[model samples]
Target: MSQTNNRDGSNKRSRILSSDVYRQRENQSSTNVAQTQSGLIIDNETALSSEIIKEQLNSVDDIITQAIIEVPTKHLLYVKELGDNLFVSLSTKII
Candidate 1:
């Protein structure tokens, strides 16, 4: 690998290792993917009807379900959940 030295005698890597965070570090650019989004929260009273979630639950069932509805990306996707409780919204714009 070649190294370039600056006028002040500092050096940097010729090629940077690209990952989720450092991929755009060259332009000092920032990305929104690393940021966590605040999603909608609802309860029993506010729960809407859906064929995707076809099950009855009590208060503590902590049900989490989703369907592959059409997104702007033209591909289908669903929510990613930590368990039966927490859910992460999935969308193409999240990038």
Candidate 2:
């Protein structure tokens, strides 16, 4: 790959967080949420706690995952198995 493409690829790779890495950083307060790529740290007061969600979907692999996005809150809840094409399209658009 060209130098620019290689740099871009590295940037993308750096943004990815393993579940272990995420769990490590997930303890910080929501108000202290960093403005950089880390991992999703959903507020405990949200409708679904991350722990509960994980337990409910136990054993599934990457069906619903979280990642840091390039935004203020930095977190993105990525649902990989949304079966409805139109819903996915609209959701992506809204996002």
lDDT values for all models? 0.38, 0.57
For every candidate structure, what is the RMSD over all alpha carbons to the true structure, in angstroms? Answer: 22.3, 23.1
Residue pairs with backbone overlap in model 2: none
Best by lDDT: 2
Candidate 1 is scored at a TM of: 0.14
TM-score for candidate 2: 0.24
For candidate 2, lDDT tens digit of each residue in 1-95? 59999999887776664645765655453554443355544444537778888897896666657755465432332323333344645545463
Screening candidate 1 with a backbone cut-off below 3 angstroms (N, C-alpha, C), the clashing residue pairs are none
lDDT against true structure, model 2: 0.57
